[model samples]
Target: MSIPKYNEIMPNILRYLNTNGEQKFRDLEQPLAIEFGLSDAEIIQEYDSGNGTVFLDRISWALSYLTNSGLTERPRRGVYKNTELAQAFLDKPTEEIQIFVKQQMALRTAKQKAEKAEEGQLDESSDLLMENNQTPQEMLNTAHESIRQSTYDQIIDTVLSKTATEFEGLVVKLMERMGYGGQVKNAGTVTQASNDGGIDGIIREDVLGLGKIHIQAKRYAKSNTVGREEVQKFVGALAVAQSNKGVFITTSSYSAGATAYAESLNGTTNLVLINGEQLAKYMYDYSLGMQTKQHIEIKEMDSDFWDGMQNDSKVG
Candidate 1:
């Protein structure tokens, strides 16, 4: 069978529990997975909070739900056995799977209400742990992205207020890391004389060593957006370069008028814009002038060398 949905996994669980008689939660997972055509990877898709994919944590939740709904009973907190509902379902074979699942859900919903009435919220932090979870490195990267967005935004805002020389160095470092060293001509290399069309830096984009596209970087405040006039000037510069492509980047949001102006394609140049958020994300992903922090270690089992199996006679 194809990979089943969240609800569909339950009937298979009931079938397994009914046939197996009883099993520890940990023990049930593998067989349950195998019977349902799920590999270790896909078993976790059957929970309420499955991060858009399945995890062993979801399998745990499935077990908890089964226990709560009266289809399974926990002999101990961790041990599970088939309940009357599970037994009955096995006795009466149903071709209509949907009805059986609905019945199972109804029982669990009622059980949850009864439990809440009897005891206030018991700590469920343990319940949050997902099964076959992500490695620490993957999780660390996820957390880092969140941290860097806020941290970098603040840093970018602060850097924008600094002297032009400081800004120049920061831009150069970031740009160099982003693979634009040779392509970038001035790149804060030469200080613009006075106000030169508000164009801060110049970059040459060569596609596979063929054709060149010019780029202009603008760093501004959050409130500031590249207006039509600014875009017009950039377009004018592209015309001077006799180029059909240009990039206008800012450390702030873009105005709709400015965006429309670039999109007008006025039979001239194609101007691409990248705002603050996009810029920071690219920088973060590319690790552009950014330092890596504490690495998280993800644990795994070594099955190639099992912990030396005992002889059959030795156990007896």
Candidate 2:
């Protein structure tokens, strides 16, 4: 079965804590997965970002919503229990519990909006007031992904507008930023355009230049596909350089034959291919050709601090 939504998980969390008494936050995952009849694979399903499991994220937001609604309380760090208010809805329908949580969330949003307005920081079109089924973290993740995709498109367009020599230089800089040369001066360099046979750039693996990585950068349109013949030529160039490590980066995709050829040489030669999307992702990840516009910090309660306070109280 598919994993349950955050709102759907809310009522079950109340029921689980009511029956199980105060339980560790980690202990709720398996029982809740069982309650929803989720399969083993579903339990381990990760978000697109691969930062966390979907089930765990939803369960955490569900518990947070219940706590905010005053239906549940955390008596100690990492432990949760239902409150007297939760007992009233223990026997209610799932829809009823969902409605209560939604209403509570709406009221909280309204209060935040008012506070922001008083501070002259109101954003009417913000997702803060959007009525959606997604949990808070899901919404943030979606927004972040949308921004990243847009940035990737811009990066491709900007790179396509630059000269061929400039494109070669950009890839070399990207390799350096990715720590290819380990802080060595002039570790990555674009070859003189006329002198370069097929290799556009080269990166030293260390200060002594004991190891080298050859790079082939192609500035092609999105519709252009790098075929097997192009990949074969790059491989021949690598052979001429007597280097087993090579990276072929393009602002276009590779053909099926090209991909197969690269894979077939896995044991003998290490050939890495980077297509347009992946190239942009690497640039963004390494902060190449990208500037930070803003930073948003997501903070959570420090469970250790609270646990220490409880321990001190017990000792006194």
Candidate 3:
């Protein structure tokens, strides 16, 4: 049989956790597969992306959706247990699984709408789950993007709340987290110089401190915009520091002319301009000043298994 859709896996996941109390994610895959009478080939099936075994991915999403709906709680990473809602659902007759699933999905949708409303972004995209066109994978992707956008907004608000010096320190920390300086000892340094060059900080490219990347941070509000003159001064500071690369990060955006001027000198100097949105994205990506709230592991098909299966069939 084919691997079940993510929704179909939800009941099994809840039932397993409800019985087992608490379990690691990997421990549930084989038992659930056996319970479903899945064949060896089906058990090994993967998605097109080669991320992981398909059955496991479905189980992961089942757990994720359940958690989102407050039916389950992940006490720590890679662990899951039933909540009161899940236990109550399980306590009902087995025939009630379908009703429970629908109820949970409705709750999840309502919660999503409430979150979008709070973010002031309740729009058409937020209603995609209700639309008929999206596949299960598309639904999962949309949910993932929504979480990321929410994080991005939170990061922007957090940076906006910091002092100018504190913001500079955040940029330095982000650079260090991105592996700019090989060692944490002096991978990056913030220069609080009032009248020195326009540069705000410097990060080493390696542990030995061989090469350097210059940094300039602007803590401007979203309404303010960085202009051409700022970029020009940053370039001048690069010249003074004898550095070829510089990163100009701002909580605001850059004007078109500023971007054009920076692009005009792309070949002469490698300058990377990071605006508020991009800066927040990088911070989230590099895990700077952030913690792992939850994890959603996406699994895909394994082509090698099928290829080997075909080879074995031909040999037989």
Highest TM-score scorer? 2
Pick by TM-score: 1 or 3, better one? 3
The regions of model 3 sitting more than 4 angstroms off are 1-132, 206-210, 297-316
Candidate order by decreasing lDDT:
2, 3, 1
Q: Give the TM-score of candidate 1.
A: 0.53
Q: What is the per-residue lDDT of model 3 for residues 1-316, given as tens digits with 9 covering 90 to 100? A: 6667776777788888877788987899889999888999998886544555778867877787678777888775567998887867765564475456556667767787888889996655544542443346656665777888899989998899989999988899898888777754878889976864798889988767668899999999989999999999999999999999899999989999999999999578899999999998999888888899887776654646643552332321
**Between prediction 2 and prediction 3, which has the larger TM-score?**
2
Clashing pairs in 2: none
When sorted by TM-score, best at the front, the candidate numbers are 2, 3, 1
Query: Residue-wise lDDT of candidate 1 within 162-194, one digit each (tens)?
Result: 776555455545655577646544432323737
Question: What would the per-residue lDDT of candidate 2 be over residues 7-72, giving only the tens digit for each residue?
Answer: 889888988988889888879999999988999999999888665789998888888888888898
Tell me how far the alpha carbon of residue 218 in candidate 2 is from the true structure, in angstroms, after superposition: 0.6
Q: Which stretches of candidate 1 lie over 4 Å from their true place?
A: 1-145, 181-198, 204-213, 264-268, 302-316
Query: Which number leads on lDDT?
Result: 2
In model 3, pairs of residues that clash are 46-301, 47-300, 47-301, 52-300
